[model samples]
Target: MRELTTDGLLDAVRAWVVIESPTNDAEGVNRVADHAGTLLRGIGASIERMPGRDGYGDILVGRVAGEVNGPGLLLLGHMDTVHQRGVFGYRVEGDRAYGPGIYDMKGGNAMAVAALQHLHATGRRPRLPISVMMIPDEEVGSPSSRAAIEAEALRHRAALVFEPSGEGGKFTVGRHGIARWHLRTEGRPAHAGAYHAEGRSAVREMAHHILALESLTDHPRNFYVNIGIINGGTHENMVPAECSAICYALVPTAAEEAELRAAIHALPQHDPDVRTAVTAGLGRPPFAKTPAIQALYNYAAMLAAEAGLPSAGERVAGGGSDGNFTGALGVPTLDGLGVIGGGPHTREEYIELACLVPRTRMLARLFETLGPGVAGL
Candidate 1:
């Protein structure tokens, strides 16, 4: 395989970051996907772009056939960012590259491309198959790509998610599930001054539900509940007839997820006259560490040590990723094997150039070692 130099890595990342693929922008994401498909095709990978559903851009799956037809490995990542166009643009400053999606995933995606180049150029074919799946909507909870991810994951023996590593360069061993609940209440509207007591204020009723939701947070168990967004009340002089709130809940395990779901469905009505409707949408199951996952971690940690990179410790991230879907399927999944940086989904996102070569080398090494029966552990 050809070596991935620092300059080459930086150029690839720059090409991707400048695309500005925000999750909600379908065409913007397609730009990046198309570019990535070109790169993969140039290296002899068969590219398949599946049309996206629910207003999302197409998902790209590039396959580089291996010598054997055995279970292959999956390099999973997302092509979308949370930032809007012009929120942040790409620029390299000394040893750091700053941009909207650089730290979150563009860097990681570039690294995967570089590693694949190395694997292909060596002329030493992989033992098992290898495929790279880049979805277009992970920032918005992979709503359109969940089925595709799960189906691809089932075909692979193991998966490596390219989410940005945790602070201190830790690999993700676990991640909490995300549950977004929408609560709406409808009540009679009345003029505040003229008939204050006649209206059952929907906003007031929503407040009670919000408090109840917040009370579900169990810090010790790592289950968190937050009522992040709320909209209600037409005017100050009128008792609001309609109110809606969006609550985000994080669960650390499947049991906790079930418990939280039951509680949310059983939420009581705060006002007798007000009608309440609760709907749960866009959730990812928690990614818990299984024996296979821990074993994979041990193998990867050894590779990092051999490559002279920092020891990658296990971590449990609070945020969710596409890894959650694979892990929930009982697949051996390892996450956070991407760029080393901070401030994801923020303006200060950047990646340290010093980690570029080492991480890429480690990834190449990982793919080489895991193929066939090379490391029969």
Candidate 2:
């Protein structure tokens, strides 16, 4: 495979960052898939575009076979960002690229592409085949791409997710289990001025439920809950008849997940006069560390030292990613093999420019060493 100079990698990242592919924008995401497909095709990799679900863009999978093959290594990432088109401008200042999706993922995606290109140009035959799965809709919990991720993961011997690294360039070893719920409370509406005593306030009932749900937070145990969004009451003078809220829960263990779900479902009726409904939303099972995961971590750390990088550390991130799906499916998975950066899902999002080359080199080396029987751990 040909080598990619630092300048070439930076230019590729800039091109991807300016595309503006938000999760719900199919046309926008497809634009990105087209760009990525072109890059992969340049390296003679086989590409497949799977039709997306109704609201998402298509999924992209690229395959490059090794001289010797069986189950291969899987490189995983998502192409969707949370920012809407034109909300954030893409520009470079000093060593950072400021934009909507730069740090969150586009940078990592570019790194993966560059690495694959380098491998192909150098004519390096991997110990096993390599498959890159760049799916759409990860910022929305990967609702439509979960099946594809799991399917590819089951075929591969291991997975490396290109999520951003944790603080100080630590790789993510575990991620919290996530679940969401939508709640509604209904009550009788009455004129405040004429019949205040006769009205049962749904807002008041919902307030009680919110407090009860927030009380479930137990940080010491890695169990937490948040009443992220809430709306209640219509006008100043009318006793409101309806209230609604969106809640999210995160837990570190399966036992904690079950406990949190039970607590939410068993929430007592704050007011018998008011009716309450709770509906569960989509969920992602936690990605916890396992023996094979640790082995992969060890191998990567060894390669990092050989590559002249600092001793790589491991982290347990609070957010969820596509890695959660593969890890929970019992695949040996490692995450955060991307450019080191911070401030995801915010206006300040950016990746450290200096880390681009080293991280990509490290990833390529890991891909070479960790494939199938190479590590033998």
Candidate 3:
């Protein structure tokens, strides 16, 4: 089997990182999408550019027909990163590439592109149809592209998510589901010094709820709830009338998710004098580990072993990705297939240069082996 060279893959990675495609910057993401479309078109695949939802960014879909008829595979990636323009810029040091989205997903996108390019160049045909779906809002929980992801996954037999590998180049077999909530408390405002007895403090009421929410974590079962952002109070001397907070909860199973939701919805306002309200809902469902996923991971482990890599497969209970959407639909899905690196969404985020070639080659091999001409789906 022909493998992509380090230099060739690095060149693609550099080109992708140079294009700033932050989630909020529609124009920047669109530019990246345009460039990606050109590459896919050159591969003899039919390309489609779906209009951005509500002026967010465009979704790019490229399809390659197989020589024989079979079930199709969906390869997914995102063009958007979490970094803003000046906050994070692309830089390459010896053996490591640092940038906003380089490790988290631009690298993965590049890997996908390079894999298809190699397949096209080498005239390799898979046993099944192949489709590449590149969206622009995965970093933000796929608000705009979740529906498209689901639709595409439903059309395919399986999905491969390129969300970046775990530390040390390990691919993910499962990821926690996430729920984001915003809670607001209302209370009567009065002078703190003169009418303290007459006023109700929303801030105090929210504090009680925060403590209750924090108690939901069950580390043994990998269920966790964290209150990440909180804001309240206008002035120190005045009784606070309103408090707002944003929190997140993670569950590893569907039953656990339902239980967490019920708990969240059941939380009551502690202060009798204050009015409390909560707007809570599922942000993303947990990508539970299923038998189909185990089969896929087994296949991936075999491939990794064949490539002379370690075969110790492990599951983690942190972070959410677009895979959550597809996995929730009962599709066989594998995630963290991008470059190996750590510190995503932080200043130290970077990708290991040494891992680029091998990871890209692995993905390319998987694509070629599973593409449209393959029979058993």
TM-score of each candidate structure, all chains considered together: 0.97, 0.96, 0.94
Which stretches of candidate 1 lie above 4 Å from their native place?
A: 374-377
Off by over 4 Å in 3: 1-3, 371-376
Error of 3 at 256 (Å): 2.7
Compared with the true structure, what per-residue lDDT tens digits does model 2 show for residues 1-377?
36656777888898898999999999989998999899989888899999889699999998878766788888898888999998878888897878888888998889988887877778765567888888899999888998889999999998889888888688888888998889999999999999988899999999998999899899898888999999989999999999999889897878878887788788888679999999988788997899888888888878777766788899998889899999999998889888787889999998888887778888777666565455542
Question: Could you tell me how far off, in angstroms, the CA of residue 365 lies in candidate 1 after the best superposition?
Answer: 1.3
For model 1, residues 171-244, the per-residue Cα lDDT tens digits are 99888898888999999999999899998899999898888889989999998989999999999999999999
Worst 10 residues of 3 by lDDT: 368-377
Kindly report the root-mean-square deviation of model 3 from the true structure over all alpha carbons.
2.2
The candidate with the higher lDDT, 1 or 3, is 1
List the pairs of residues colliding in candidate 1: 1-122
Which pairs, if any, clash in model 2?
1-120, 1-121, 1-122, 1-123, 2-121, 2-122
Name the best candidate (by TM-score).
Answer: 1
Candidate 3: lDDT of 34?
Answer: 90
lDDT of each: 0.88, 0.86, 0.81
| Tens digits of per-residue lDDT for model 3, 295-337 | 7777776776776666636576478888888888989888887
